[model samples]
Target: MSMFSGTIQTLEQSLNYASAKNRAISSNLANLDTPNYKAKDVTFKNYLAKELSQPLQAKRTNSKHLSFQGEAQPAGYKTIRQHATSYQHNGNNVDVDKEMANLAKNQIYYQALVDRINGKFGSLQTVLKGGR
Candidate 1:
C-alpha cells in the first residue's frame, strides 16, 4: 500500500548516488594541486542483488510491534578515499584526465535519471487525466 512504486524508489536512489558521485569528482578535481590529498570516489551497492539474496521478513505496521533485530540496511552509496595510488609527486592521487572523464560520465548518468523521472511523472499525469 505504498504510494510510490519500487521503480521510482530505485530511480531516486540512483539520482542521489549520481549527485554524490559528481560532488566527489568535483572535489577531486578542485584539489588536484593540493599535496597529500587522496582522490575520493563514490560507490553504490546494488540493492536489487541484496534483496534477491536475502529472505523475506515481517514488516511492522505499528509502533507496538516488535522490530527486526540483528539486521541493518546497507547504504546505497558511500564515499571512499583512494589512498593506495598517487599520480603526482606531491602525493596527490587525483588525475585530471580521469576526473574529467568521470565528470562527463556522471553528468550523462544524472541527465538520464532526470529524464526517467520526468517520464514517470508524465505517465502519472496522463493516468490522472484519464488518458487524455
Candidate 2:
C-alpha cells in the first residue's frame, strides 16, 4: 500500500545518521581547544546492526490498541564521549587528524545516500511519465 519502498526508508535513516555523525564531528572540532572537552562520536554501525537484528513491531493506531508486551524500541543514535584517551594536556581527547578524516568519510557517505535517494525519485518520475 505504501508508495515508497523500504529502500527509501533505509536511505532516509542512513541520511539522518550521517547528519548526526557530522554534527558530532563538528562539535568535536569546535571544542578542540576547550579544556576537558572529550571527543564525541555517533555509533552508526552498531546502532544499525542492533536495529536490523530486532524483530519489527506493529504500530498502535489508537490509545485503546494493545501494545506489544516486553518490547521496547531502541533509542535513536547516541553521541558518546570519548573518555578513555586524552590527546592534550587539557584532557581533551579530540584528535584533529582523526576528526578531519572522519568528517571527510562522513561527507562521502552522506553524498552517496543523497545520490541513491535522488536516483530512486528519478526512477519514480520516469515511471510517472509512462517510461518516456
Residue-pair clashes per candidate: 0, 0
The alpha-carbon lDDT assigned to residue 77 of candidate 1 equals 71
TM for every model, in the order presented, reads: 0.77, 0.79
Question: lDDT of all predictions, in order shown?
Answer: 0.85, 0.86
Which residue segments of model 1 deviate by more than 4 Å?
45-75
Give candidates' CA RMSD values in order.
5.9, 6.2
Model 2 scores worst on lDDT over the 10 consecutive residues at 67-76
lDDT of 1: 0.85
Best by lDDT: 2
Residue 85 displacement in candidate 1 (angstroms):
0.9
**Model 2 Cα RMSD, Å?**
6.2
Candidate 2 whole-model C-alpha lDDT, 0 to 1:
0.86
